[model samples]
Target: MTQFTPDLASRFARIALGHVERRYPFKLDQVLLGPDDRRSPTELHPVFHGSFDWHSCVHGYWLLARIGRRFPDLPEAAEITALFDRKLTPELVAGERAYLDRPLSGGFERPYGWAWLLKLAAELEQRMAPAERAWAEALAPLAQAFADRFRAYLPKATYPVRAGVHSNTAFALRLALDYAEAVKDQDLAALFRHKALAWYGADADCQAWEPGGDDFLSPALIEAALMARALPAGAFVPWLDRFLPRLAAQEPGALFAPATVSDRTDGKIAHLDGVNLSRAWCLREVAAALPVGDARRGVLGKAAETHLAASLPHVASDYMGEHWLASFAALALETA
Candidate 1:
C-alpha cells in the first residue's frame, strides 16, 4: 500500500488542527443554539450564521472525529470531549425521552443527539487521546439510554423514509456500532446491525430505504458499510463499491446548465434537488476510512475538489456560517 503523500497528509493535518483549535465548547445545553452559534438548519447565501439542528451537530461530530484522527495538538479536543460529556447529562433532558422516530425533521430530539454524541465520544477515545478513557466512559450511559428509548419509541414506526430523516436513522445505526464497540457489548451491537439490515431490506415503497437510486443512497450505503465493518459482515462491501463512484462523479457546472430550480447557488438545499455538501462529504468520509490506494485516493480527490470548488467560496458568509463548509473543506483538503 502506498503511503499518503506529504502534501495531502499535511493538508489534512492543517484542517484537523484548525478545526480543533477553531471550533469549540460554545453551547451544548441549548437544544437549538440559533445560527449565531455556528449551527443552523436552512442556510441562506452570503448570510452564513449558525443554528442548532440535528444535521449540523452530526456533521460537527463527523468532522471532529476526523480532526482527532489527524491532528495531535488539537486545542479544542478537550473542550469537545467535555461537550460530549455534557450531552450525556440526564439532568438536562429530564422528562420522557423518545427513540427511533425520524425526529430529525421534528418528531423527537433525543435520539439524534445521542447518535452524534456517541459517535463523537467513540472517535475521541479512539483517535484523540486514549488517556481520556474515563471521559469517553461518561458518555456511554447516554448512548445506552438513547438506544433504550429508541427501541421503546419505534414499536409502530413508519418506513420508506426520505433523504433527511432516514439519514439520521442511518447515523443512529452508526452510533450504535460505535457504542457497541466502545463498551464491548456484542449483543447490543448485533441488535443494531440487525435493525439496520432490516431497514435496508424494506420494500421499494419505503422512503427510508433505497434500492440503489444513487446520490443519497450511496452515502447511506457507505455508512452501512462502516457499521458492517465494526460488526464484521461481508455483505456491505459490494454495495459500497457500487455506490461510491456514482456519488463521486456528480459535478457542479453540469447542474446550473441543466437545472429545474432557478438559482442553484442560493444555498438552501435541505432535501431533494440532487446536490448538497452533506451527501458529498459522506463519500469523502468513507474514502478516508478505506485503505489508501491510488484508485481510492483519486476518488476522494475528485470528491474533495468538486465540493471544495463549489462550496468552499460560499462558506465564509453563508447562512450556516463557516461550520459545515469549513468541515467539508477540511475533509476535501485531506483527500486532496
Candidate 2:
C-alpha cells in the first residue's frame, strides 16, 4: 500500500462512483437569511450536492479525478468520466458557485469545504486528457470563488484554528497551497505561506492532545505536515523537531497510535475512522519531509502503515462513512 496500484486505484474509484451522485441523506451546511434560504441540497449546489455533504462531495470528486489521472485505463475510468461529464458542465457548476453569493452564504462551508473545493479544482487543473481539461475549465469559476474567499479570509484570520475537525486552519491552508501552486497564483501562494508560518512558525512542543471524541483529523500531524510543505527543508527540520520533539522515542503515544472506531453507523462516531486515514496521510507527508536516514522517518512511516491498516478496510463499510471516507483513504495512499 506504499504506492497505489491499478487495482487499488480502481477500487477507490469505484467506491467514489457509488455515491458522487447519490443525492440522498444529505447534510446541508446552509444559513437561513430568509424563508427562501431553505432550499434542497441539489438546488444549492448542482454539482456538489451528494456524498452526504458539500465538502465530502467535493473530495469525492477529487478522488475520482485522481484515480482517473493515475490509472486512465482502469475499468471504472469510463464511469468516472461520464460522472464528470454529467455533473461538471458550466450550467451545473455555476449553480455550485452561485451558492456562495447568497446573503447568508458567507460561511457556507468555511475552510473544510473550501479546502475540498480547491483540492478538486487543483486535481482537475493537472489533468491532460481533453475531457479533464474541459472539466477544469468548467469548474474554474467555482475554484476561483473559493480561492478568492481564501484571499479575503486569510488577511483577517489573525489566529489559527487548532481543531481536529472541519475548521482546522492547517488542513485548509495545506490543501489550498496545492491549488495555489497548481494555478501559478504567486500572490495566493505567498499569502498562504506567510499566514501559515505566522500561525505555526513559533508553535513548539505540541502536547499532541488529539483524537477527540469525533475528530476526523490529527491536529498535531496535520500542523506538522503544513509546516513541512510551507517551510524550506533547512528550516522545516528544526521546526518539526521543536513541534514534535519526542518523535524519536514516540513519547506522544497518542500520535503514534491509531484511533478506535467503535461504530461507523453514527456520523460523528464514524469520524474516528477518518482520523486514522487522515493521520496516515499527514504522517506520510511529514515522514516524506524528513531528511534521508532520519530515525523519525521510520517511526512515522510505521505509524502511517498501521494507521492506514486500521481504517482502509472500512472506507466503504457504512453509508455514514462510505459517503466520504474513501477520499481520505485516497489521500493516504495516493501521495506516495
Question: What are the per-model C-alpha RMSD values against the true structure?
Answer: 8.8, 1.1
lDDT of 1 by residue, 1-336 (tens): 112344433443334333332323223233343556343222210110122344344555556555555653556556555644544244432221222222342334444555655565566557445545554454455455666655664444555233444345665665557766776777767767666655654322112233222232233533533444543445444544443334334322332121122343443432212333443444555555565563654655455445444544444443334334444445334433
TM-score of each: 0.55, 0.98
Full-model lDDT for every candidate: 0.44, 0.89
Candidate 2 lDDT, tens digit per residue, 286-333?
889888999998888889999988988898889999998888988888
Weakest 10 consecutive residues of candidate 2 by summed lDDT: 1-10
lDDT of 1 at 227: 44
Runs of candidate 1 exceeding 4 Å displacement: 1-69, 74-107, 127-131, 153-160, 165-168, 202-233, 237-267, 270-276, 284-304, 319-336
Superposition error at 230 for model 1 (Å) = 7.2
The deviation in Å at residue 106 for candidate 1 is 11
